[model samples]
Target: MAAPNTSTSDLYRQWAATYDTDGNILQAVDDLQLANLLPSFVQNLRSSRPDGRLRVLDLGCGTGRNTKRLLLAPSSMPLEVTGIDTSEAMLAVALEKFPEATYHCLDPFSRSSPLPNDLRDSFDGLISTLVLEHLPSDVYFSTLVSLLVPGGRALVTNMHPDMGSRTGAGFKLGGDGVRVRGVSFAHGVQETIKAAQNAGLEILEAAREVEVDEEMIQRWKGKGLERTAQRAQKWIGVKVWYGVTVRKIGDRED
Candidate 1:
């Protein structure tokens, strides 16, 4: 299969219109994986400050599906939260869902482009869900480091290249499908910790899990005989979700 070189911003803008209503919306395999992962991260933050609010940032927040979970109860926070995404359309949906929080439509991943100076290192905690895999290897580390303040915590999750399906598998071309131009890096537990460590972010916890929904599996099987799916289930779990909480330990000057 020929790899497509589609811009993340453009692809998301196209996807935003129907993202929430898609079959893989509420209990989607990927969404469910994230829903399970974030609460643990929140609990870690609460442990640090038992009786105070913690600032948080949700980067590459698409339509706020994963981000919304943080805004809802038991995972709810007693702090200010902000989200940034490259697609305004997706951000619009996020805005509708969580009008109380601020949302920015910008590419925070660009090294040359910084978030508004005031927002720099302004958050106490940060989380990026289903977003890191979209970035190239070097950009991934740079983006994480640039966004953190000293002692701030970050939790980032991405599609597991070794297990979960890559961008644009079942969908048709130019039809709001995922776009991945070959694998720049395999996003797994070790790489996530290593990236944060290289960025001077200390890892507090790291784990990987795969939960395959029988419905999604049947859907794929009906579409075609996906050998990757078959091979993965033989040994590896179907869904690949990873969560890492890290803190910035070094001075910014270094």
Candidate 2:
């Protein structure tokens, strides 16, 4: 259960090589949830701009997992895609895999960071998947709110407090299996909702709570991740990830 106290950027920089290959059960659950969630989200975006003029932003788009999905996802027109992350190493990998999409190495959460404003109110849709735990719980919704255009939709996902408080995102390093834990704050569901309300974002109805199940466990085992399978087996019926759909309505306070 021991993990290093490394910063989020440095940790992901080191883990970028193995990230996509690792049989991460939570991310697998997230993928399953996204399959159901994307249609409605895409419909909402299309409803806003029927002419197919849509732009999307991906926050913490590690190795362009979801970004690639968006690129390949069926669309009326070529959807403009942009992704941002704090780690240049991860972004490098993302850029190589999906060279069409723009990538920025920036962290919006840092108060001293001066570059995020250039992106304000710029996107038609936004996605920040499983990135909230590394950020301050209070500022997440507000920051997300600022980056979107009025009436624009967003999909946000987080590591659920139930599982995160016990053991959040961590990865084994090298042959020693030295675990390097991502910087995390396990925000509870109520607290997360309260923060969204405070940010004045319009919460949409198509939210999701992803739980570990037999299918996820079987996937891990089939992928040669016996350790992960054993861990997820104990978490059956327990929610490990939460996804929320919210909109940037007429702007109020940022």
Candidate 3:
């Protein structure tokens, strides 16, 4: 089989229109997990910084789904969210949905300085869902560490490394029936942990989940995607996603 075209920005631009409605099971799982996990982090930040607004960076915030989630979450402190993505098309949809949040168009991999200097070590928390696989290891850890203040927390999620070989860690026809694929790189669990430690982040928690369940299988069957349902069934108990929470323990060198 030929490799799926992995042009990151172009592919997302083509897929942006249908991304939200794509009935993506993985995305659904991510949403649920993030919803459950984010509240505690936000609450902690709020308690620590009672006098000011909490700043958050949503890296690779495609269509702003996770960004909106963070904004909607009930918090004691106000949230100032800034979302960044390489594809203008993706950012356009996100901006439309949440005009209140700041959106930036930037190529994380190609840019020498992906974020503004003024924002360095300013964020109270950072969240990147299903985005890390697309970033180089050095860039991944360095950018994450740079954006967070010491003692700030971060949540990073990606397709499980074990499933990357099977699924290429790349995009396919999302639930919306768009035939688009973006480039992705595979990094193992140990590699991710090591990167965080090397960047002076203290790992708080790590989890892996098998997103496919009977409910998801039935939903696929209802949509008349029998093959997809079968594929989902085959992996019912197999882990397909990984999430990690780490805290910045030291100040950025720069």
Best by lDDT: 2
Comparing 1 with 3 on lDDT, the higher-scoring candidate is 3
Residue 58 error for model 2, in Å? 0.4
Model 3: weakest 10-residue lDDT segment is: 169-178
Relative to the true structure, candidate 1 reaches a TM of 0.76
Ranking by lDDT: 2, 3, 1
Candidate 3 matches the true fold with a TM-score of 0.85
For residues 18-134, write the lDDT of model 3, one tens digit per residue.
777655556756766787888876777677677777889898998999898888878866699999898899999999898889988986555655567767788888999988877
Residue 222, candidate 3: C-alpha displacement in angstroms: 10
State the number of backbone clashes in model 3.
2
| Pairs that clash in candidate 3 | 22-175, 22-176
Report the CA-based lDDT of candidate 2 relative to the real structure: 0.81
* lDDT comparison, 2 vs 3, better candidate: 2
TM-score of each predicted structure versus truth = 0.76, 0.91, 0.85
Cα lDDT, all candidates: 0.64, 0.81, 0.76
Model 2 TM: 0.91
| Candidate 1 local lDDT, 1-254, one digit each (tens) | 44465566765665678665544321245555666667777777677666667767888787887677777636344657788888899899999888877888888877677667867767667888767767765577667666777777787666666553443212223434443342234566676677667777787764655556556466545755354345335433445555566787855321
Which 10 residues in a row give candidate 2 its minimum summed lDDT? 245-254
Q: Rank the candidates by TM-score, best first.
A: 2, 3, 1
Decide which is better by TM-score, 2 or 3.
Answer: 2
